[model samples]
Target: MPSELVFCHPDGGIYGLQFPMSNSISQLDISTMKELSNFVNLLSRHKNLSSIDLEFHRKGDVRAQRIINHAFSLNVQQLTIACLFKKNKKYSHDERVAFPLSLSGSKTLEHLSLRGSCGLFDEEIVLTSAQRFSSLTTLLLHSITLYDGFLSMCPNLKNLTLFSYRMTGSPVLRISHPQLSNLTLEKGECFTHTVNGGRFHVSAPELASLHFFGFCPQMFTTGDGFPCLENAHLSFHSRLECISGSYAPTIVNLLQQFRNVKHLTLSMEIIERLNSSEELISHRPCPLANLKSLTLLPEVATFVQHKHTRVIMSPEVQKYLLSSSPKATLTEVLTLI
Candidate 1:
């Protein structure tokens, strides 16, 4: 193979195949295959393909499955399948069943991303099938309802990212993956439907980098010391104060758990919450001895043309964070546009 071909369309499938000088292709992204026979006939000839991307509109189960079946037949290293959501339409049961079937026989897959909702029933089958990919390393799941049994099956998974999960019933999630070094949890709104929030008990001993954004977890319990964690990003909304008056202590305790973090990022809302009650800090000094870089995000501007470029923190707030890590330089502030 001497060429790569990528075809992306919002509605229909590609009708023609163009290769430069070779008979085989390297990469392909066939979106919404209206003609499965044509796509199968086109891809069956190219055995050297390494990466594939397939996108499907809501309720295109038959077409999506056939395309996926053909794509997985090759020795691909990366595969991305998205069952796009439509605002007015609900996904059919057949589409959910077809989601995991696409990942069948993926032994050599290294990177995989399943975006959009695959429904709860199909997700269980998807997680079960994911375990067969022995070479899998990185996985990203967006808008998925995750549970305890999901990550346990991925023994070889190293990097995991979960976004916008709608969790209820106070689920207790346990992250006990030893090989997972980098973990990211963002855009999560947990425990809205239920009275009690959930708990996440992490046991990633080799975890070196953790980035948390948008919403904070209800509670976090570490299995052991996160000895290898080097970078951490923490952001929380200001509304947390309304949830509980003692959120300062809760936030401080969470920070204390990451004693070995070298690079830490915090939003302005978090800093204000931590410093809201001076009595807590005076009673318990939560120092991050290994911290080297502290980045503050609250001071960031909302728009590009805004006037303020640099943000200043009150002396009391500066002293509070600096006291924990005396060797840390002045906190750096950056805006989020």
Candidate 2:
């Protein structure tokens, strides 16, 4: 028998095994019940672990919950769980895995990532008292349905990344944190459609960097603005036809929130949209006031001929963008698709 055993399939037969010279295994990637059992057995011999990554392909809610409980018991610092679903496969409500409530109160955990289709704070699970992740600092949630008050669980978080997040029970998504410094919001695989003029309200006084990609919300409000911000990157893409007049004002207003940023970057698509809205641009002053360096990125293209093409900003758009920050150095970056 080998020192370490791993079973990739649901059957009891072992497919692979490993023999370590010493008890120094710190990280594990588990997918099946047999693998999980071997992990539990290995834990008795080696008590110290750094991280655990778990992936589930089908219905294994009970096993998944048990794995999470065991990870917490071992005081694992980093945990990542992803529940993958097959294409065109329909699963019932009960088949969906619920986020284990037991791990919410973990104090040793520092990083947590949850991806794919999983239920978070579903109605089936109820909490009697408040739960807090006292030591968690970094959190990444992708392709998951989020409920209000989710951030309240992690009080000391410093970095947050939300990709394709779908909101439940409220149209408005509010993010307010005191110690948070970096925030990235990207419209990933599950872009939430704008309904009833959906919006985002962010209030992070200590924020230093901000990156927003894909379709922007109808309205983005940051109370008192990001006074401590130094870097900002804004890129907008839409599936529908680009209507300059439709998104011009919203983009302009969004830029105003980052007026204090010293380094700024804009995509070519944004420049084009602003160019067609000359009338609108003429009326409003430039949002950026003090920029150290401004960079323009080329739009992505699939054609072979357009791979290394240089992107040039029209004089009208350049003047409008650089009017307030005349001392800022301008640079256009060449991008290859």
**TM-score versus the correct structure, for each prediction:** 0.74, 0.74
What is the lDDT for 335 in model 1?
A: 44
Q: Let me know the TM-score candidate 2 reaches against the reference structure.
A: 0.74
Clashing pairs in 1: 300-335
Model 2 gets an lDDT of 0.65
In candidate 2, which residue pairs get closer than 3 Å at backbone N, Cα or C atoms, i.e. clash?
Answer: none
Clashes of each: 1, 0
Q: Write the per-residue lDDT of candidate 2 for residues 202-302, one digit (tens) a residue.
A: 88889999887756456678877898899998865533433335777777777777778899988776786777777766776776787888988776332
lDDT of every predicted structure (CA atoms): 0.62, 0.65
Best by lDDT: 2
